[model samples]
Target: MTQHTDVVVVGGGQSGLAAGYHLRRQGLDFVILDAEAAQGGSWQHMWDSLHLFSPAEHSSLPGRLMPAQAGETYPDAGHVVDYLTDYEKRYDLPVQHGTRVDAVRRNGERLLVEADSGTWRARAVISATGTWTRPFFPAVPGRGLFTGRHLHTVNYRSPADFADQHVIVVGGGNSGAQIAADLALDGNVNVTWVAQRPPRFLPNDIDGRALFDVATSRRRALDAGHTDTGGVASLGDIVAVPPVRAARDAGHLHAKPMFAQLSADGVRWDDGSQSDAEAIVWCTGFRPALAHLSPLNLRRARGHILTDGTRALGEPRLHLLGYGDWTGPASATLIGVGRPARDAAHEIAGSL
Candidate 1:
């Protein structure tokens, strides 16, 4: 049987939830399809020690406030999941979890969404499956030759997982630094961190502003092409502030240059140095999973979905969120998804 609706939202994360909320507010009929058994998406996969750099006030969804404990810097991944679950219940969003959309095709004036359960026809579709869907692993020589247990930072949960092992964390990103520090303090593991560039440390406080805020400001400047040549701070500076600084001073944090090659025993760096570790955790970034959408022909050469904030390839019904700078405050954060959702819903409503 083919079920029909006004809008069919794919992926029930923050973006999909926000879309459904706005669709309901506009008195439109819609159905939300998500692959996960529950909401929260990437938060469910985040490390146990992970917390949002953004404050509680900025982490809330469109209509509800994120409940936080007193003196909490930012909510943990579990808290984020709880808040998203609450948002879904509070708004009575029509979400069908565990239903993955296999393929989306335009059927005359509507869209045909084929899922495992059945087929759905809708006037519009919102592809809110954020960029983190695919993990980015570089193709380094002898990567497969390494005898160590290797995994990405996405799969890392806690230092307990790497206990009594020699762990080498690659990448100079926040995740790499934090994980290396955690493992070093575990007393059961030997930790080594390798990066391409020497990290430029930033103070926890910069003229009364929090380091996170300063980093965000700098990111905005870079995005807007207004970054100062010498004043710009790198990822290391952003992560080296406050808590991270203390971690470094306590001998829990150390950094070396990038890895040049891998061997049967361990890794060799660009400076001809070698480290023998039992486990290697790649803290590299993520990429978009668009190979399934090959029929669309909408991506850029760089693998990003080439769409303006409002439309894709002149198709107003196809909206994208969390791609580059389109998602407002929530662009990279879960909270930033709301604006894109609302905008996508309004655009769909107007088209209909």
Candidate 2:
């Protein structure tokens, strides 16, 4: 069956929901397609101890503010899931669960969204599928030959699974720091934290809210035709989340240089130092979840779609949201997705 709507939103996470809110205000009929069986989106897959770097007040969607969780300075994954669930119901957004989008391609005057459940033809398509679904693992030497249990951040759950084992956590970003600290704090697991460069920690007082402000400033500067002054990255890479700070202060979360290679049972560093480990966790980041749009042949180098803001340069009828700065500054974060989403909906409404 072919369903018709003014817009078809891919992914029902924060970004998609934000887009839906603006679309509703714009009075556009739209449907959100979500592969996840339920409401939480990628937050459902995060490790048990994961918490937002910002407070509940600062992390919110377009139309609704995330309710504060009592006794928690920073909301955990579960809290976020509950907030999203409530947001969906409160707004009465049209969402189709468990529908995996297969392809998005042009069909003359409109775009065709082919999914496992059904097909939808829409005047515009907004792809808000975030990066969580696509974890990026660097091509490290001897990775294929490693006999240990190697997994990406997406597969990691809790420290219980890796207890009493030597584990190597690779990557320099927040995930790497968090997981490394998580394991180190367990005391049962021997952890080797590896990063390409020295781990940089932001001031303890700074958090996601501060980072968002920095991003906003940088965005305004760029919009005013000024040189790039840098954003959260200029301050540091890791936010001194509570657990990470504790672990660092306890001298349990020190990072080592990137390894030279991996062995069947261990890793070899550039200085010929060797450390045996039973597992390796790749905390490396993720790429945009954009395979569904492959049929359009819009991808350029580095898996990026050329875009002027969120609108694809190749196809103005399609907009990419919440991927990263390319879409909008801090667009990937909850508090940051609203502006681009609003702009995208505004542009779509005007065009239609």
Candidate 3:
């Protein structure tokens, strides 16, 4: 017999945990299906030395505040993982680990979630399976023939492996700059940063706190029925954190436009110039991990499912959470996802 639940929370990441907290309060019989065998979500896969843009005080979920060493301003990836692991145990959220959902289909008025482990028939389904597993790369000509070693941010570790080598760092986002800085620290590595546009670093004072405030205002404006221009775009760019600042001082923060094409040994510029690269590190970014939802016919162009708030358009019984701001205001951040989680769970409960 197939297991049944009042609600099925997909992904078991920060967003899923948040939703689980609220669902438990609503007395809803819910299960958080996690693809990983263990907790910590995708933070476990981020490159080493990665740090949050905001301080611990500002980066928190709904109930428990994220803890950090007293003087530590930004928490690293391991710190985040520890906190998330603790959060799950603290809330006692019913999470079924190692159960990867293959697809979610409509079963009459309910939703059928078929996973590797079992199938769940749920009154409502919340998809919080974020983008970590889906790293993106550009379609550069001859990219397939590039013989040099290459890696996206998803698999990147320390820069120690690229010592004394000519490496091209792709993407102007924070990851791109940080990796360039890491590889250039000894001044022995030839690190070239590339992106379609130059990296924009927010002022030092404008850390996570300021970003959160702006997002909150945008949320409030939308709640009052106003169009938010999504000024949050800049927030996703590089921040002038210590490492990035050090990189700027070292003259390593500069970026080149995306190369015209990838050569067997390096890249060719549109101007017929060439740079020798022994390896390439891509920080291009990620797409939503929505392959499991493909069978539902809800996916729209640009790797997203259209939604009015957290509810998938025309699918009132299905809610998509934590994919990005499009799914909820500031939904990608630890501090921002709570509101949507709470609201989504409440709505699901009331409908049932």
Candidate 4:
């Protein structure tokens, strides 16, 4: 079956929802196609212990303020999913759940968005597919040979399942720190956090709010053709979240250098020493989910699609949103995504 719309959003996550809201404000007819069976994007797949480093207000979307639970300063992964679900319902966003997009190709003047459900011919296509689906795994010797359990942050659920086991948490970012801290609470679990370098820790007073502010300032300076002198912390910098701070105070927060090889039972350190472990948790990171855009020939060699603001550099009809800092400074975070999404919506509306 084939349908038509002014715009077809390829993702139904926070970014896509934000774009949908803006598109509605423009009085544009659009449909949001979600690959998942229900609402909630990457937030639904996050580990049980994950919580926003920022307060509810600083981590909200454009239209509504995310209200926190009583006595809860930071919302957890479940809370985020609930809020996103509510946002979609509140706006009555035209979202087609369980519609897995297959490919997007040029169909004359409009773009043909082929999904599992049907085909959509859109004047413009807004792709909000985030990075959580593509987990990155560093190449380590004997990685394939190791039989012990190995998983990424995407697959991790809770610390209880890792109890009574020695686990190696890999990556120098927030995920590694948080997961390591969470595992420390379980007395039976022994966790060694490994990274290429020491992870930076943010001052307890500052959170995602300050980070977003700094990133915004830097982006503005760059937009004005000026040098960015502001010092904003990267998203990976360990926020002094209660759990991580408690873990640090308890002497459980420690960093180890990256290991050289993965043995069948455990990993061997670069210093020729071996650490026995039952499992390995890779919190490395993710790549953008742009496989469906292959037909457009816009993907760069570095696994990114170049864009002028939100519009694809070579293909203006294709707008990429919420991929990462490359698309827009601070575009990956919930609060940071609004500007880019709105900008893309206006650009699409104006063009049409």
Candidate 1's residue-wise lDDT over 222-281, tens digit each? 568994432324323444534466678996666887778998889987788777878899
The predicted structure with the larger TM-score, 2 or 4, is: 2
Q: Can you write out model 4's per-residue Cα lDDT over 1-352, one digit (the tens) per residue?
A: 8999999999999999999999999999999999988898889988888999898998999999999866789999889999999999999999999889999999999999999999999999999999988899988899997888999999998888887899999987888899999998767799999989988888888788988888888888888999767546544478889998899889888898888999988999878888889899999999999999999998887689989999999899999999977777789999999999899999988998
User: Which candidate order results from sorting by TM-score in descending order?
Assistant: 2, 4, 3, 1
Candidates, ranked, lDDT: 2, 4, 3, 1
Off by over 4 Å in 2: none
**How well does each candidate superpose onto the true structure, as a TM-score?**
0.88, 0.99, 0.96, 0.97
The alpha-carbon deviation from the true structure for residue 297 of candidate 3, after best TM-score superposition, in angstroms, is 0.3
Error of 3 at 76 (Å): 0.6
- Clashes within 3 Å, all models in order: 1, 0, 0, 0
**Candidate 2's TM-score:** 0.99
Per-residue accuracy of model 3 over 106-132 as CA lDDT, tens digit each: 989789999999899999999999999
Best by lDDT: 2
lDDT of 2 by residue, 39-66 (tens): 9889988998999999999999987999
Q: In terms of lDDT, which candidate is stronger, 2 or 3?
A: 2
Q: Which pairs clash inside model 3?
A: none
Reference-based lDDT, residue 257, model 4: 87
